[model samples]
Target: MRDSAPLTPPVLPDRPRRAARPLLAAGLGRRDAYLLTLPLAALSLLPSWLGGPPDAFLRVALPALLAVLAGAFVALLLGRWPLERVLMGLLTGLWLGLLGRVAFVLLAPGSAPIDALALCGTWIPVLLAAHVWMLGRAAGRVASQLALGAFVLVLLVCGALHPAFALNTVGNVVMQILLASLVALGGQRSGLLRLRREVREQRLGADLTGLGDSLTGLPDGRAARRWLRQASPRRLEGLAVAVITIDQFHHVEATHGEAFAGCLMAHVARALEGALGDDDTLSRLGPSELAALLRVPDDRAARAACERLRLRVASRPLDGVNVTVSMGIAVYGGEGDGLTLLAGAQDALDDVRDAGGNRARLGEARRTVVEDMTPELRSA
Candidate 1:
């Protein structure tokens, strides 16, 4: 049996976690898509003047109008307009883009009628796809079917006018339908997945919020007690608990109302946590009461820690209202369990309360009363 025993390595825990998805998705919202529109628009307009126009007026006016609409899109997006309002701006840009091409064709002196009509075959479908994408769900499907029907009618007109061009136009229209359908399908799936993820995260956050104080986000009494039981004797060789209660808490709560009192506690909790060391654990024991467990070398170190935390709380303001805290500190390793030590700290707090708070007291025993000591003696 002794020979059979062999050495084994200890199992280590996994590393810190990362987000499930760090990369941005292929489908972009209004915010991300708007950023790329200006550059794309610029490129599209760069060659507008290459071919001479039928009239100089059309050449000058069309690009300028499109530029103005681009600026409007940027303004609407930055101003945080509602979704429906922003959609209006986007649709306006597309409509202006279509009109710009029409003006260019009309102003050209040698342009044929079929050449002018070809612009519809090219630009109208694009506008319809944008409409489909923006509308989404039932509205999008209706828009898609309507667009398909309109394209078929346009194809019939082109066949009667120019049979040779109509064959190629049919292929182009078919390709547009397939491409738009694929993009819409992908975007819809990505949006649904994003919604599911957001719902799940909200539920998890709500559960975690329930396990802690709503205002301070500090672990409540139940979690605090469980942590103490696990750490007091096993993890921390020397443990000292300091119970800090806000001075005149009941009166403050009455004067300011519950909402204001909760806000004040949250500010105080942040200050207290910032002043603490890595080895110290802070929790909200109750309304207006905070509990801190300090891992220190001796009783002197614990009191010093308590004084630092008390001063930090006293110096801070709760929304322009000055506040102070009284601490009752009890050290372990002298005698008793974690709960007994917590009781001793509470008993010492009673003495501090009796002496008109804004001070601290040391716990010698469960029923023992220690004389008042100044901040100097308490720290030493």
Candidate 2:
């Protein structure tokens, strides 16, 4: 028995996996980084005020004040401008400020060669590392990687040009690179986790609200009712609600199977959805009924739309079986609420079903026939 058993282990089927989220792809809006500029600008001036001449305070103070003011102005433009554009402007301003400092050091009469080189070695790496971290957090992974590579190249060139200080410069460069890599990885992981949490929360909210029908993939009745309740009176004006029911759906289901009935319902949903305008909303209201919220100019337009839907459904053949629908429309007169309008449409649907099926009716002073029953027509 043991010799007859298979030598290899059985291969199990692979389970479908969710797509992995891209690292550092979360959007960083203006609100996340707007306040960072003010503090960073103030801190950039600290070294200048501490080590420079007595008049250095006046020289650095004006530029720092200007930078803070510019950051403030950018903050005011947050909602008007795109976040990426705003971040680009801020990064440009920072680089320009660093270049100005480099020029100041180079032009000073008493400054030694070592002092200028030291300034570059210290501040260049600091500024580049800060930028790398910021870009990782705000811009994205590509930008952060680009900055990281550029800074490494610059450091390598500096080390080659100055052989005497190469040891210390190379060490500093290594430490900075490690620090930057760690910071970027940590920030990206945190951002990915936050994004995942937000997505899960949104899915939960949707499930709780029952806003979508799992079978038909259309908005469910709850969503339709919610929209009706939330819509303003001005918006509700000239709007119409039409309830559509699959004629003799129970009999069809009994004749066919439940699975076929479900497929038929989905087919009818697609047909009704295709006939609707861009502004109209289609929803599944029951097992065999769907509802449409149409934005029409008048009752005549609403009736025409319902008639078109009726014709569209009857014209299509699903699995060689003829299908027909009954529709009831209730136009909003700027008086009652959304639920009331839905109730009126439901009442009209009952009337249409009572007097034969395969027609459209308008809910008004009297149940008005928008389309007459035509049982002689068959789907091709």
Candidate 3:
């Protein structure tokens, strides 16, 4: 019995956490797919050589247009599908290079090898643009811009280095430089628009996901008091407000740690939801505290209603964990004013603390009292 237990590692509890799939699954509809149209738009620069015969025109027109569309599609696909994207780059470059060779030879004889290189050069920039557009706002913007710039410099250097093809080389270099700059600028502008859209979506999601805490979502004491006046207790007879908090919740937190406290609060919130009506409005009133606005029309009925609510809560355990709730109830006495109800209700709720844990007390709503920003409340 005294054989000292082999020093054992402590067991750590796993907290229930949300899955990342939600964030990833948060996607754009057809409205968001408009970015993909960029590459297709680039196809507008088909072989429009009015000087050439119909046969010559068709020969240039078909290949060039196909090259543009295919280049963009492959690039866009590659960005989304990494392995496929690499494959697309290689295959696209090969086809474009071959096409460029043909286009160059037809337009300018073999004497201009530099012109041949320039046609081939268009492939890289087009693909880069498509990849950047496909990458959305994240990694692609920088990548696509850098690729365009690098490709331009390569063309310029190739031109400057090969003096034999000076006329062809210089003309191609200047034109390509401008084109690259435009592509780079276009990609960046699209990136900026995409970034803004992403930010807006993230902000809207945060609002929907119940991500905000009580402090931000709940109005301050003064704000709550003022809002209650709109409740119009006279028009509707009995609107009861209950303010409840877990006394010594901090003490439990000190002993069990914040994780346990959070678990407890979550459990309690669930318990509260189960005990109340579907229409009841609830908010975090203070640290480890909650407030409920119960709409019941009369005095005795309101008191009975409050009692039933209290009993439902007191009887149910917090997720099978040993914990208790202290409930404080205040009824709106046809006084629709905010401060009167809030202060009176909060004060009455406080009185139950002296009577020991697991008790509910009722009173008249106070007039024009400020609200407390508790950590527990979140948006509905």
Candidate 4:
């Protein structure tokens, strides 16, 4: 019953975590932020049409058509459909709006007139809000302040010309700007937080393959650093760090091509993985270097582990090409830190490579020799 209780808890958390992911992903996406515009546009058009002239179709159709075209232009801007081209689309749409309004006034000559100024004023706020939303952070901040200034100017002019509708216009402009700001800032913040939380949770969970190399399935250098930082204290009690590097790896890359080199690395990685024990961690520290942290009782055991790995790799044939690995081993009992320990192992590996590859050197008290360094080191 006690054994079963531990197993049951692990299994229970998996189902709930899996179910919650899709729910969070579907909430508050980029397109949902622009949905309110459709309804707002419809409401803006409807009131003017209801109290319009007998030739209401001619008066309303042009404004409605321009509004639709303007809205489509805003969508293209948001979609980032080529800046050079979308700017042209915006100019064409603006010209069409003006031409349509002029055509409506000329054709629908009537005593019960359409207030074209009121229609333009209402549509301007909606378009301004959309433009502000599409602008980048630095530009958007400036644009928002400019929009507020424009609204204030409109309010002062409209108050003198149309006192009865000025208050309504002021309210509509404020509402549209406020809505756009909330959608742009609040929606972006919430979505970013949700995405970050998801990634962090995944990092903490069982599936940690993301922390490793895609091709080799070995923990990457970042992961290696993190593990070393965490395990350095325990390593001081007695642990081994070994850095294994393939000799003349760039020559292999240049001769065989990148794809073949990648395959060879993957093959080598598998052979190294097979040599590691349950307590050992294998990591890809560089393009041609693999680092392993081994759990050992004493210095001999650490040396044995390094030799075992080196022999295992040398014996393996990758795609009919014979391969060999050189290793440098360092014990952590008398080290400054984990990084220092890794550097010591790298120094030892360099010594072996200089003496000719396919060998393992354990606990040599020397820093990395500059003359013994490869072309990559000399260039750096």
Candidate 5:
């Protein structure tokens, strides 16, 4: 939301940095989105009868409307499509509209359809627009946009000066060639390149290995669940997520140094990792919290993994001391996304957190297996 003119149109990606209110990036290049609303811009004609048309606006508004939508359609859907090529699409589409509007006046109407000046108004707007786009910062990428625009304007001027000297055929053909060239060049630079990077960053963010905590090297529940949501349960066999917490963390900290408690957590993380398969992600969610996203082959296999991890943690020594950890497991894969899985695991964790914290509770497995792992199970 730049303080653009009213209804200037939307273009570009949303501002990724802004959390509360995202703004659309600068530029509106999609065409189908534009053509869809072409009829609406025509209604701008109504204001003409009241206040009179602005200096050559009504003539250009419809063209600009069509151009913007055409540009966006090319960019968003047709990856590898160039903004320059999209600009060409806009140029050709708007120019075609101009030809239609002009032809409508010349060969059809008994009264004057469009005066020569009004006809020139059509090309002028398109040319002026091309010139502006060429001057924008993106212009630095393709030096030829400015040149192409200049060439098209020159040809348009040649046609405007003498109809006998210029035929629409020659101008139309030249415009098409320039547009195609622009598309090949611009589409690669701005369109496809920008799109691929966004996808790559998103994939890496969900990567299981990338997001684990540095100190504990365990994963928080949010990252674990998101990773499981993306992973294939069928391929990995039995995949489950779990939340684990030490009981009465305050008492434990008071009994031992906080440094010793940290050592205990580190020991617990190391033990879980050693106990589970390599395809697991673990993190610390809070002071007393730990989460795990694990993939095994089947339900029985998942249960075995859970049991092995529990036994290992229980049997392990931390600073030559033993501290029990309660665990809650939630199976993930195609079951649901985000909170549906996480909340189930959290509910189970809360149950273990409450019922003395030395054992593992099954949420997704029981929810799927026993069919009676009710939300009330935790309270019970």
Candidate 6:
């Protein structure tokens, strides 16, 4: 016997939101950052070609261009491998280091080589900040802190070795670091907001579609149709659809109130569902009709299943009233679609109602002999 408790609609659990990480907050993905390198590198070198001597410019520009091209080729080869991001970061660091050295040489030609090297070291902090903004904070935080420590060390060394040059450039270096920090923070916040909005929209869409039937707590006709459309050909083999209609459902509603009729229908749905196998699906197609999709070996098995369902419904009493269901079964013969099969089942159900209303009828070219049901057999 089935459980006597009333059926309740399924409640979907709240989906846990992922904590926003600093790494994912950055809108720029690894691939986008890698692809943007070429254009940015070209723009950075424009100053050297426009203002510096051609011989000195080529010495730096040619090597940097070759390195950029080689890095791009390697990144493309790696595709989506995890190591690709690490390789790209290394390549960017090398390129920035080269540019820093060139900048010190061109801007402070007469300064001592050691002083120029100290100034060039300032590029490390800038590179770290750029990394945080482009890829993510988690990827670059450790390196950024180390670079900052190195920057402070360089500042102290320059102060001891060449106090005048250190004093002159300290303000400029501090300003550059501050600017990079601001940019990184802004990018993270913006990306986080966009990510949150996208998650909310996805949750809303899922909630809208996941609700099934309100009364019987079973899937409705729409869900049944969707399942039929999505089911594969292998699964459809030997599949049969049975449409069950309660006999004199309108008279039951008229005699008892509408509320009692609704309760009776829910009870019938549960009884029918309990009779079906776990592999089969039962859905409420209308107020008086429910549809079952069954996997049977042949017409005999399908007929037996429908008869079992009919007996199960008639055996139970709802609010002191006996109920009996008439079923129509149609099997898939590998020719027509789900809609056609459903229509055939409905046609068979009409035939069952026409010939007294309690027995199950098989609909197809090879129809099974249906036994006649006398007025004494049907429910009141």
TM-score of each: 0.48, 0.44, 0.39, 0.42, 0.40, 0.42
Every candidate's lDDT: 0.63, 0.66, 0.53, 0.61, 0.55, 0.65
Query: What TM-score, to 2 decimals, does candidate 1 have?
Result: 0.48
- The weakest ten consecutive residues by lDDT in model 4 span 1-10
Tens digits of per-residue lDDT for model 6, 1-380: 01011122357999999877674465766565665565575465555456445354356655666566556646655675564465555545554554445344434445344434343444544565565554555655555555545545544554555556534554355445545645554565567657755543343222223436778866778877776776667767888999999998999999998999999899999899788775677778899999998888876677777877888888898878999888888888786777778788888888888877887877854353222323232211
Per TM-score, what order, best first?
A: 1, 2, 6, 4, 5, 3
Number of the top TM-score candidate: 1
Q: Write candidate 5's Cα lDDT for 275-336 as tens digits.
A: 66555656778777787767665444444566567767777767667767777766655556
lDDT of 2 at 380: 8
Give the backbone clash total of model 4.
Answer: 0
Q: Model 6 segments beyond 4 Å from truth? A: 1-211, 368-380
Q: What are the RMSD figures for all models against the true structure?
A: 15.7, 20.8, 15.1, 15.0, 22.2, 20.4
Give the range of the ten consecutive residues with the poorest summed lDDT in model 3: 371-380
Model 1 residue runs over 4 Å out of place are 1-210, 366-380
Comparing 1 and 2 on TM-score, the stronger one: 1
Q: Candidate 2 overall Cα lDDT vs. reference?
A: 0.66
Tens digits of per-residue lDDT for model 1 on 63-161? 665666566567655866666556556555555545454433433445543444453435555555566556665565565566555545544554555
Model 3: per-residue Cα lDDT over 20-105, one tens digit each: 66522777443234335545444433433332333443476456656655665565554564543543454444445444443343
Considering only N, C-alpha and C atoms within 3 Å, which residue pairs clash in candidate 1? 54-107, 54-108
- Whichever of 1 and 2 has more lDDT, that candidate is 2
Q: Stretches of candidate 4 above 4 Å error?
A: 1-210, 366-380
